[model samples]
Target: MVSTVEVPEADAQFWRDWGDPLLVSIVDATLRANHDIRIALSRYEQSRALTHQAGLDRYPTLDVSGDVSDRRVSASQAFGLSRAHRDGELHTANLSVIWELDFFGRVRRSVESQRADTEAHAADLAGVQVAVVAEVTDAYFRLLGLQRRLQVARDNESNQADTLRLITALFQEGRGTSFDTERVRTQLAFTRSRIPPLEAEAAVTANRIAVLTGREPAAVVTMLDRSAALPVYPAQINAGVPSELLRRRPDIAAAERRLAAATARIGVATADLFPRFTLGGLVGTQALGFNTLFQRDSETRVVSLGVGGSFLDVGRVRSRIAAANSAAAESLAAYEQTVLIAMEETEDALVRLSHAQAEKAILEQAAEASRSAALTARQQFEGGMVGVLEVLDVERSRLDVENLLAQSATQQATALVAVYKTLAGGWPQLIPEPQGDAMAQR
Candidate 1:
């Protein structure tokens, strides 16, 4: 019954609801044009080409060649050659065909392995896409969080400046001591000092976003200069049952596909234990003169059936088969490990996200309380009911709480991104799988 519950609006399309257009655009660009994604795509293409080659293993091969030659043979060497080779101006043309009959399924198994490898690479590309999206989203959230912190620092600086002015005025009128004025000045300077480091952090994050989107740092800096607020966290998230992870997680899928490839390779190697049968044919004509090369009497035709095996090296073949089996075992273990890791990652993200939300709620209340206390202290200081030191202390507490609140927001965003990545969310489902199509045709 709980599983059937309707998902919240923000949970269904998390990015669309929580992410601004710029964030979405940056993530899209990163997935589409990032160098890492491009490299994965290139690797997928390489695997696809290998799959095509493997599929050709069962097909016959044919070739045609024509040659014209002039040669003079010595009298002593003529005894070891045919009359045609002993003369000059020999002309020959031939067509040859060679076909390996896959009676033992060697070629078929090879094709299967290659196809599985290709699918694994395709999954790898999807994983890269997922990672790039997560990274860009996480980085953008960090940038927003930093900006919020910077704003808080600047606000505090302004508040402290006002406090310092009041202290200066009180001192000028002999109502405040030089020590109080100097202490307020020190607090104001400290507040002002926070701005530069915050600005630097924000700038670095912006540059990271720019590189993620395959753009120049200056361009990203210009684009991100526009003011934006951190997104509100969604109250309800529907993370479907863990079983869905097998299908949704690209890394797991990749590992599983690799295991399939490795298993298929065992068959490929085992096939080597049996005899290999090959059928070859040659049709040709030869004559001393080019015009007579195609003449009826000059025609020649030959056909042959070849059978070969590693009968003399049975130990070598068995060793190869054993190695393939061991590799398949390793791949199986890896697949299992990947599945466990995927589940662990998703669970970890969920736990962390929950904790971050709980922490943020408490911090939000603390910030509100601190804000009220700061306001009250400032009022009391102006009314001569409290010291400036009390006001500064409250203000400092408020600043720290606000900064923690911003960091909490960033942590939540990071955890959410991790969840999405582990789930392989936003994978390009519509992307063409060329190897699948080829396998279907086969």
Candidate 2:
């Protein structure tokens, strides 16, 4: 089914180019400051260090040893040991080298496994980057939506208040009944009630964005205090094909890299079942006199080639191999699952975006019609052609539809973010650095 899907350049950067500058800046800041992303980057560094350490095993190892000591001996003890009684200084130095031959390819396989592990960690970091950006973008859009809803509610409240005043004036003048005045007041109160909760919800969403950006919640609330309009999105989204998900989605890439690492580890484990070979040598000189420490006559040399294997614990080695194979199998399954999830999320986002656009269009028309109806009803009521309740009902319906319109716009924006996230849209190429360092660079 995926094979039949239209594919584009899935790895392209859509969000950075298309998103609002403020939102893009927020996402960039979050990527650099968000603790989760920092943690993943740290893990990537650790993996790189491990890989380098593993590669070091491929080269010969060398070390230097030296010792200097002074001792005073008693006359009887000195005579018994060396036929001399005196205070003496002794010095010794040694340089040793050990190189393990990769006859069974253990070192190579281990290095390969570590390299794959490092790549897996890099992919993990990318996945975290994608997640943080998406989270911040979603929060931003939601906050804007709530703010717009609050504005609509307030506008409705004001309109209803004006109606209540007119109705109260009419009742006082003996032109309207007390029941109509009370009903208008009640309607105004209900409309006013929606404001506080919407404001609170908007504030919470702002706090979420602030936290995502690694700032204090109150500080974020202050920063985002200025009312802003909802962002505009491009009419058409270019979502690449389904198969592009394998390369574009970080979770899929991470899962695949982990699978590769697991496969490499199986080879590493298998290498343990074979004989290990090493060659070690030491060349050093020791002398009783410090001046003669480097003299040829004091030179000592040793060299050896060694081979060892686990003869008794064969079952343990096989068990490890079996475990590695099992892990590889699990990673493979995880990779498949990741691919499916990426595809599902992308498809869902596409569907949501399409529906939100359609709904927004319909709601826009409904809101306009309601506004016209409310105006007509108000005019009719003033002329004694309609009751106050009829005007109130139409105004309330207009408010409801306008609120839905605002929410639908938010949904469309959020769905766009989801699509970009599912496509792994914004992150740059791999240049792993510490969080502090990355931020400093920015």
Top-TM-score candidate index: 1
Q: Residue by residue across 1-442, what tens digits does model 2's lDDT show?
A: 0011122222325446544677667777787688888788788888887888888899999999999998778867667665344778888899999998998778888888788777777777877877777788889878878877887898899899999989999999999998899889989999998999988888888888988988888766876776567755655666656765577776787788789889988987888888888899999988988899998799988999988867357999999999999999999999888888887888898788788877877887787788889989999999999998898888889888988888887888788788778778633332221222110121
The residue pairs in collision within model 2 are: 7-241, 8-241
List candidate 2 segments past 4 Å from native. 1-19, 70-89, 426-442
Please write out the lDDT profile of model 1 over residues 132-190, one tens digit for every residue: 77888888888887888887888899988988998999999999999999988998899
Question: To one decimal, what is the Cα RMSD in angstroms of model 1 from the true structure?
Answer: 9.7
**Model 1 CA deviation exceeding 4 Å by range:** 1-14, 76-86, 426-442
lDDT of 2 at 66: 93
The candidate maximizing lDDT is 1
Clashes of 1: 0
